[model samples]
Target chain A: MFVWIILIPILIQYTLTSVVPMLISFFLTFTDWNLVGTWNNVGLDNWKRLFSDRAVWDSLKVSVIYALYSVIPTVVIGLLLALAVNTRKKGTAFFKSAWFFPVITSVVVVASIWKWMFTAEADGIINQVLGLFGIEPQFFFGTRLALITVALLGIYQSVGTAMVYYYAGLKGIDTNLHEAAKVDGCTGAQVFFHITLPLLRPTMAYVLITLTSGALKVFDSVYTLYNQTGGPQNAANTLVMHVYRTGFFNMQMGYASTIAYLLFAIIMIISVIQYRITNRDVE
Target chain B: MKKRILNFFFYVICILLCVIFLFPFVVMLFGSLDGETKYAVTLTSWFPTQFSLKQYQSVLSVGGRMSRWVLNSVIISVIPTITGVFLDALLGYIFAKKRFPGRQLIFWYFMAAIMVPYQATIVSNYLLYSWLGWINTYWAFLIPGMWTVLYMFMMRQNIAAIPDALLEAARIDGAGEWRTFLQIVLPVSKPGLSTVAIFSFMNNWNNFMGPLIFTTSEKMYNLVVGLSSLNQQSASFNMQMTAGVITFIPMFLVYMAFQKYFVDGITVGSVKG
Candidate 1:
C-alpha cells in the first residue's frame, strides 16, 4: 500500500508527460492544425502529402547518406582504437581521455570549434593547411561538401563512445580462448579474425543501432554549423531537422507529426533489421 | 626485431589518433585567446601572437546574459537530475523488488515507450506545454524531463543485483520498507545512483533541442541555446571560441570528476543486453 502510494505520483506524471503526448502525437497525425487557432481532422491528407513530398525524400536521402558516412567510420575507427588502447600499457589512460574528451564536450562547443576551423576561407585553419600544400581553399560548408563535413563532425564526436563500448566488449571476452588459439599456432591476425571479431557481435549490434539512430537524428551540430539553416540549399537537412523546420518554422504541426512518425518507423524498421541480422550471426 | 618494429608502428598509430582527437581543443584554446585585431586578420594565424582576455571578460561581464544562461542551465540541470534520480531509484526499487498487480505489463509499457523517438512526440508536447502556458517557462524543461524511463530501467538493473538476504535481514531487524530502502538499498546502490545522476546532469546541461523549442524568450535560454544564438549574432572568432569554452568547461569538469562512473555506467548499461 505504501509502495502504491509512492508510485502513484510518478506513474501519473509519466502517463501525463510521456503516454499522453505520444497519444496526442498519433491524433495529431490525422489532423490539420497550424499550432494556433483551430484544428480539423484531415484524415490521411498528411499521409498522402508525405508520399509526394520531395523535400521529405531529399531530407531522408541526406540523412541516410550522412548515416553511412558517419556510422561506418565511427564503428571501424572505434574498434581499431579499442584494440590499440585495450592493453594495460603506460600512457594508455591519457590516450583514452584524449579520445573521449570530445564525446563529453557539448555539441554546440564542438560545432563552434569545427565551424571556426573549417571556415572555408584563407584564414581557416584547414584551408591554411591546404594552402601550404598548394591546394586551393574549398568551401566546406557549401552544398557540395556540407553533408560530408557535417558527417565528419558526427564521427569525431561519437567515435569515442563507440570505442568505449568496444573496449567493454573486449574486456568481457574470455582470455582462455585467446590463449588456446595462440597455443594452437594461431597468429595475431588469425586469432583476432577467428575469435575476437565474432565475440564482439553483440557490442557491434548495440553500437550500430545507437550510432545509426544518433546519426539519423542528428541536429545540433548541423543546426549550429549552418547557422540555423540546413546547410547551403538544404544539403544537410536531416529528418529531425525537417520536422523542426516544418512544425516550428512553417507551423505545419499536423504534417510535421506525420514526418516524425515516418522517422520513428524508419528507426524501428532499421533497428529490427539490424537486430535480426546480428542475432542470427551470433547463433 | 620484427616484433619491435610492429610495436613501434602500433604506438605511432595510437599517438597519431590521439593527436587527431585532441588537436581541435588546442586550436580552440589558442583561438579564444587571440585579440580582436589578430582574430580579424584575413590570414589569421593558428597560434596567438599575443594573448588577450577581452573575449572572456566580455562574455562573463555582469551586463551580458551569458551568466544568466549559466545560472538557468544550472537550475534546469541540477533540479531535474536530483528529482529524476531519486524517483528513478524509488520506482526502480519497487519494480525490482515489490510484487503487485500488472507489474510486468506496466514495466513493459515503459520499456516500449522508449522506442518512440522524441521527435515523434515533441510536436504534441510543444502543443500541450503551450496549452498549459509553459512555453517560455523553466517548467517546460523541468516537468517532462524530471524522470526518464531509460534511467529507471538502468536503476532497476542495478537494484536487482542486491542480495535478497540483505532485505530479509533488514525485515527481521524490524525496519520499515522505507527504512530498508533508505539505509540499505540506496547506499549499496551508490554506483547506480551516481551513474544516473552524472548522465542526467550531462544530458540536461548539454541539451539543445528541448530548450530550443520550448523557450521563446532569450532570458529563459540555457547556455547551449544562448551560445548558439550568440554564434549567429557574433562574427568574431575569438568571441565564438570564448563562448564555446565557457559552455564546455562545466561538462569537462564533470567528466574529469566522474570519469570512473562514466566508464562503469557505459559498461554496465551495455552488459544487460
Candidate 2:
C-alpha cells in the first residue's frame, strides 16, 4: 500500500505529460480554433488546407535543405574530428571536452554569437577574414547564404556529439588488430580503410539517425538569428519553425496542430525508410 | 623514439582541434565584456579593450518582474528534475528486474515516446494546460517533462548490468520489491542515476520552448526565455551581453564544479551501461 502510494504520484506526473496533451491535441485537430476565440468544429478542412499550404511546402523545402546542410557536414566533420583526436596521445580528454562545449551551451547564446559573426558590416568576422583577400563584405543573413551559415552553426554545435560517439566507438575496437595490421606492412591509411571504417559502422548508424532527427527539428538558431522570419528568402524556415509560427505567433492553433501532425508523419516515414536501409546493410 | 614523435604529433593535432571547437566560446566570453556596441562591432578584435560589468547589471536589474521569472524557472526546473530522477529509477527498477505480464509491450510504448517529437503535440499541450488552469503555472512545465522515457530506458540498461543474485537475496530475506529497489537497485545504479539527474537538470535548466508556449505571462518564463527576451528588449550591446553573462554563469558554474560527472554523463552510453 505504501509502495502504491509512492508509485501513484510518480505515475500521475508521468502520465500527465503524455496523456493530457495527447487528448487535447486530438480534439483540437478537427476544430477551427485560434487561441483568442471560441473553437468550432471544422471537420477536415484544416487537414485539407494543410496539404496544399504554400508556406508549408516552402518551409518543408527549407527543412530538407537545412537538414541536408547540417547533417552531411556534421557527420563528415564529426568523424574527422574523432579520427584526429583518437590519434592524439595526450590531452585527449581536454580536446574531447572542448569539442563538447557547444553541445551544452544554450541555443540562445550560440545564436547570438553567430548573429554577430554574420553581421552585414565590414567589421563582421567572416567579412573581415574575406577582406584580407580583397572580397567585399557579403550580406549573409539577407540572402540564401544566411540559411547555409545558420545551418553551419548548427553543424558546429552538434558535431561534437557525433564525434564523442565515434570516439567511443573507436575506443571499443581491439588495439591488437591495428598492431597486427601495422606489422603486416599495411600503411596507416590502408589500415584505417580496411579496419577502422568497417568497425565504426555501429557508431555511424547511430550518428545518422540522431543527426537526421536533429536536422528535422531545426528551430532555435534560425528563429533567433533570422528574427523568426526564417532568414532572407525564407531559406531557413524549417517544418518545426512553421509549426511554431502557425501555433504561437499566428495563433492558428488547429492549423498548427495539423501541421505538427504532418511533420510527425513525415519524420516517421523518413525514419522508417532509413531504418530499413540500415537494417539491410547491417545484415 | 618513433612512438614519442607520434605522441608529439598527436598532442599538436589535439591542441589545434581544441582551439577550433573552443573559439566561439572564447569569442562569446570576450564579446560579453564589451563596454559599447561599437567595440563589439569590430569583429577582428580578439581581445576586449574595454571590459565592464554594466551588461550583467542591467540584465539582472530588468528589476521588477524579472526576478519572478527566475523564481518560476527555478521551481519548474527543480520539480521536474527531482521527480524525474525518482520516477525514472522506480520504473527502471520494475522494467529491469521485475517479471511481469506484458512488460515488453509497456517498455516499447515508453520507448516510442522518444520518437514522437514535441512539435507534434505542443499545440494541444498548450490547450490542455489552459483548460486545466495549468497555464502560466509551474505545473505546465513540471507535468510535461516528468516522464523522461529515455532516462528510464538508460537506467534499465544500467540496472540490468547488476548481478541478479544481489536483488534475489534481498527479496529472499523478506524485503518487498519497493525495499529491494531502495536498498539494492538504487544504490547499485548510482552512476546511472547521476547520469539521469545531470541530464534532466540540464534539459530543464535550458528549456525555452516548453515554457514559452505553456506560460502566458512574463513572470512564468525560464532563465533561457528570460535572457532571450532581455536580449530582444535591450537597446544596446552592453545590456544584452550582460544578460548573456548572467544566464551563462549558473550553468557554467555547474559544468565546472561537476566536470567529471558532466563528461561521464554525456558519454554515458559509450563509457558504461
RMSD of each: 2.1, 3.1
Per-residue lDDT tens digits for candidate 2, residues A181-277, read 9999999999999999988876787687768877888887877777766677777788888989888888899888888887888778766765565
Per-residue lDDT over B76-194 for candidate 2, one digit per residue giving the tens place of the 0 to 100 score:
77788888888888888778877766678667756766667777888888777787999888777767777588888788878888898888898899998678888888898888787
lDDT of 1 by residue, A1-283 (tens): 8678987776787788888987888899899899889999999999999999999999999999999999999999999888877876777888898899998889998887787778777777788878989999999999899999999999999988998999988988999999999999999999999999998988888888888987898889889998878888999998888999999889999999999998989878876776566566546
Query: Which residue pairs show backbone clashes in model 1?
Result: none
The DockQ value obtained for model 1 is: 0.61
Query: What does candidate 2 score on TM?
Result: 0.91
DockQ-based CAPRI category assigned to the predicted complex of candidate 2: acceptable
Q: After superposition, how far is residue A60 of candidate 1 from its true place, in Å?
A: 0.9
Instruction: For candidate 2, give fnat to 2 decimals.
Output: 0.47
